[model samples]
Target: MESLHRDDEKRTLRRFLRRQRQALSEHEQRLAAQRLCHQLKALPEIRRAKRISLYLPVNGEIDPTPLIEWLRKRRVEVYLPVLRPFSANVLWFVAYQRDTPMVRNRFNIWEPDMRFSAQRQNRLPAWALDTLIVPLVGYDANANRMGMGGGFYDRSLAFMHRPGPSPNLIGVAHACQQVASLPVEPWDVPLTAVVSDQGYVRRTR
Candidate 1:
């Protein structure tokens, strides 16, 4: 069926892009991260944000953690994506502070401990944040993104589909991850832009 072919194509592309980013040397990764943060600080979305969510990098994903100190200095509330307990492929943004407890999730990605995340006063839904720095496996010039295939982000950001308060989604990746084109899916929640070490690709459509 046509759906099967598209899925196959997406799998192949994801693997290739993942490998490409993982191959970057530590030196390259550090430089890329610095350049990325520099560019992000200039964006009006980031500058005006009162609360923002960011992810910790793994497997060569561009590091957005560098911006935490900068954001904190400005008194902007910073949050990290916590895998919601008992919910499949769902994420809840929990406050990340100097004392926030940390633990590794099943995927080996670090997140705030469940005890802290369970406290309703400490977290916010995706729509409530002013901006979010998302991770990506691959992207196109139009800012179309291919995630790690888990659909966690796509599902968490599904609220964007309706006419309501939609947070600014900024997909972050190394410049090498940009591809010529990508197959967009119905469940795909488009990003406001994709920023890399080189520059940014804003979604024109």
Candidate 2:
């Protein structure tokens, strides 16, 4: 059943993402992103965090540009994840600024400098973060997440939550991406909350 669920979830995600990508009539994609941004602008979490880590947005990905701008204006320390280069499966978080230069990765998504990316960026203790905003292919109101089959975020968050000093794990997604329920593996890590154009789902229920 787990394997079947995963397959179904992947197929659904692929179809939804592709349709979302296609629905954009050039300017529509930009507008959709902007709408998503506008909705998140009023979230208490986005308004409160001092130290935050976020995955850089990619194609048809919910744009974090507005949040990033807000963070910069408020003098919050913002970080971005970078998949390591040269045979490392770990992720690293690097300090991001408006001026931080970005180059495309092998997958064609824009990423921060590999030299300062998440895994290679720093060795700071995990408990130092106040909040983390994760991206997911699909998620539910119950905080269950279905990622792109990589457990980097799961392993990292699980490790960070072991003792004291763990940050809140927030997820950002489009309302369309929300599922009613999802398959959970032993390694899956639940999020604290989720924000979408539909507003926030606190996930405490």
TM-score of 2: 0.80
The TM-score of predicted model 1 comes to 0.97
lDDT of 2 by residue, 119-192 (tens): 35543333577778888777777877777666768766667545655677877777777877767677777678
- Provide the lowest-lDDT 10-residue window in model 1: 112-121
lDDT: worst 10-residue window of model 2: 117-126
Full-model lDDT for every candidate: 0.92, 0.69
Q: Judged by lDDT, which candidate is best?
A: 1
User: TM-score winner among the candidates?
Assistant: 1
User: What are the models' TM-scores?
Assistant: 0.97, 0.80
Report RMSD (Å) for each prediction in the order shown.
Answer: 1.2, 3.2
Which residue pairs of candidate 2 clash? 92-118, 92-119, 93-118
Error of 2 at 56 (Å): 2.5
